[model samples]
Target: MQVIDLLHTATRELAEAGVDGGDLDGQLLLGACLNKSRTELFLAADMEVPEEARRVFLRYLERRKRREPIAYILGEREFWSLPFIVNPSVLIPRPETEFLVEQVLAACRPRRGLHDGWILDLCCGSGAIAVVLALELQRDIVAVDISCDALAVAQQNCRRHKVDDRVALVKADLLTAFAAERRFSLLVSNPPYVSRRQLRQGLDPEVAGYEPLLALDGGEDGLDIIARIKEMLPVIMRPGGEVFIEIGAEQGPALLRMFAPSAGAAELVKTVEILKDYAGRDRVLHLLLSGYGR
Candidate 1:
């Protein structure tokens, strides 16, 4: 069939299967099958698809129809304007997480010699944040994740971005493997924050069915991992260090309370504030450790 006709069929199939952005997904998949850019496909809409390419496009279409994420199908996703490999083993990097990177860069850019100690990327899925930080800061980083499979994917990304030598991958649950020596000067994470209730209610089929659960389930209150990170802050973070954590939109207040100055909390915390995403909803929790105080 002609490129245009095949694209129409794929789009209709995807849309009927309840896929969002079906037309765009069709274009991307079809273009991939033909080994052509979307623009090239559009320009050559009248050209007939080769038999082999048509079969591959149909297979890709079926996968999309089953709610598999395009990134998983394509095996890559762009974050911080750099392409990173992704799979079911690791969560696909989202655009909003770029804001977390921006906040970290902004926080460290003004201070000379801020990269003195190690930068820890906790729960570093696919090493997207670590790769970006290593490139942007020219600093050494330790990217940690609990899943060995995720770490494997992260290692590929680090090598792909040519930051393998700079960004070390560690398999550990949070900071459990690290010594309590306050080694990290800066920390960033996009831990699982989707509440159990939220998951039970439902997420898009692409997310609920395909993405790694270890990277999505934030536990009963969605703060299980976040809280654990909070508890380890005193041991892992240097006095003047800062932590940037990506959070759910409605999680800002709860995080604030969790880190608030109370009997057991906020002793090591100097400042705890939530940064809003583009939509003005809480998306990142920026915490400053007390002592040398930046």
Candidate 2:
């Protein structure tokens, strides 16, 4: 069949299945099968698709129709302008996480002193944050995730970006694997913050059905992992270190209170500010420890 015909069929099927951006997904899936760019696919609209390629396109279409994310289907997703391998084992890196990376860079780039300390990436998943930071900061990073499968994918991504040597992938439950003496200058995380009620209420099939639950469930209030990280901050963070954590929009107030100085949640925490995403919603919690730059 012609490329255009297959694209139309895929688009219709995906749209009927309630997939958003069906046309774009169709283009991407067909392009992957043909190993062509979307532009090239359009240019070759009249060209005939090979039988094997056509079959693969149909199979990809079937997966999309079932609400599988295009990133998982394509076996890759672009984060911070670099392609990273992804699968059911890891959460697909979202654009909001880029904000987390941005805040981290902004905090550390201007200060040379912050460069000397250790960097930790909690719940590193596909290692997107670690790989990007390794490349951007040219520093060593220890990335931790609980799932070996997720760690394996993170490893592949690290190697793919040629940052494997700098980004150490560790399979551990949060900071449990770290020693008390292991203080870090900068710690960043995109941990599981989805509440149990949110899960029960439901997420898109692409998330609830395909993404790893280990990376999504944040406990009853969705602050379970964040709370744990908060508890460890006073112990693990350097005197002047900074932390950037991606969080739900509604979570800023709770986190503010959790990390507030008066709350004594984490005594050394000097400031707790929530950074907004593109939508101006609370997205990241930026914390500066006491004695910053000292």
Candidate 3:
């Protein structure tokens, strides 16, 4: 059959299976099977697809119909204008996390006396945010993760971005690796913030079943990891250092109250601020250390 006809059939099959981006997925698979770009497929719509290519295309379509994410199939995803290798070992980098990176970039930009600054990306899956910092600022990065396998993927990605030299991958349980003498100019993370109850209810099959559970489950209230990081804030961040974290939509006010203590505790102020995505949901938190006096 002509490639165009096959593409149409695949799209219909995918749509029937309830895939949200069925047509686009079908076209991408078709392009992959032919070892051609998606744009190339559009230009060659009328060309006859070889028999082998057609069979492979059908196989990929079958996998998609089962609801496997396209990123897993492709084994790579684009983030921060760069390509990153992704697998079941790591959580897929989402668009929402870009805002966290933006906040960190703003915080880490060069100042007159600040040189050789440091940034810590806690739970640095695939090293996306940390690597970006290294590439942009030419600064040192300590990318930490609990899972060695996930760190391996991050190592590969760091090498691919050519910023591996600037990053130090450490295996530790949240701020444990940092000595009292060490401190970061900026700390960023997109830690596992999904509650255990959410997982019990089932997440996307690709996420709940395939993605690392250690990277997703946030215990009872989804604040397990966040709380640990918060406790470490006073020790790890230098004066005037900041943290940018990605949180679930519903946890905004709770984060604010947690960070900003009053009366018995030091009065927390706007320095621990929240930012919303275009969806108007609180997705990123930018916590400044300026207001806290030593």
Candidate 4:
């Protein structure tokens, strides 16, 4: 069949299967199968698809029909304007997570950033944040995760981006695995925040069935990991250090309460701000840690 005919038929099939953005997905898959750019495909819409290309195109259609993510199918996702490798082992990088990177860059703009330049990237899936930060700043990033499979994917990404020299991948849950006497100048994370209740209700099949649940489950209330990270801050962060975290919208007020000037942590946490994304959802928590008055 001609490119245009194949595209039309594929689009219809995907849409009928309840796939969102069927038209765009169809074009992308078809372009991949034909080894042509989307623009190139359009330019030669009347040309016949090669027999081998047609077979690959059919396989691509079957995968999409089963609700696998396009990024996983393509084996890449764009973040910070750079393409990074992705797979079922790691959660797919989303645009909202980029907001966390922006906040971190803004916080470190004036200084040399990571003094002695030691930085910690917790729950560093795909090492997307680490790769972006490595390129954007001169720092030593120790990225940690509990899953070896996820770490493998992240390490590949670091190598692909030529940041392998600077990013250290660790297999640990948060910071407990690190015994080095190190203090980070800045700490950044995009930890899992989806609650058990949220998952029970069902996510899109692309997410619910295909993506790794280890990267999605944030425990019962969704605050379990966030709260744990807060407790570990004083031990890991340098005086006057900053933390930028991606958070669920509904958790803003709760985070405020958790960070409120309390008998134990009031003096340790200097300032807290709930920043919103373009969608007006409360998305990130910016914390200024200056220590408990020396």
TM-scores for candidates 1 onward, in order? 0.97, 0.97, 0.92, 0.96
Residues 239-283 of candidate 1 have per-residue lDDT tens digits of 878889999999998988888887366567888899998989899
After superposing candidate 3, which stretches have Cα over 4 Å from the reference?
110-116, 263-270, 290-293
lDDT of each: 0.90, 0.90, 0.82, 0.87
lDDT of 2 by residue, 180-273 (tens): 7737988999999999999999998889889999899999999999999987876778887888999998999999888876777454777779
TM-score of decoy 2: 0.97
Q: Weakest 10 consecutive residues, lDDT, candidate 2? A: 261-270
- Model 3, position 73, has a per-residue lDDT of 84
Superposed model 2: Cα runs more than 4 Å off = 292-294
Screening candidate 2 with a backbone cut-off below 3 angstroms (N, C-alpha, C), the clashing residue pairs are none
lDDT agreement of model 3 with the native: 0.82
Q: List per-candidate RMSD values in Å.
A: 1.6, 1.6, 2.2, 1.5
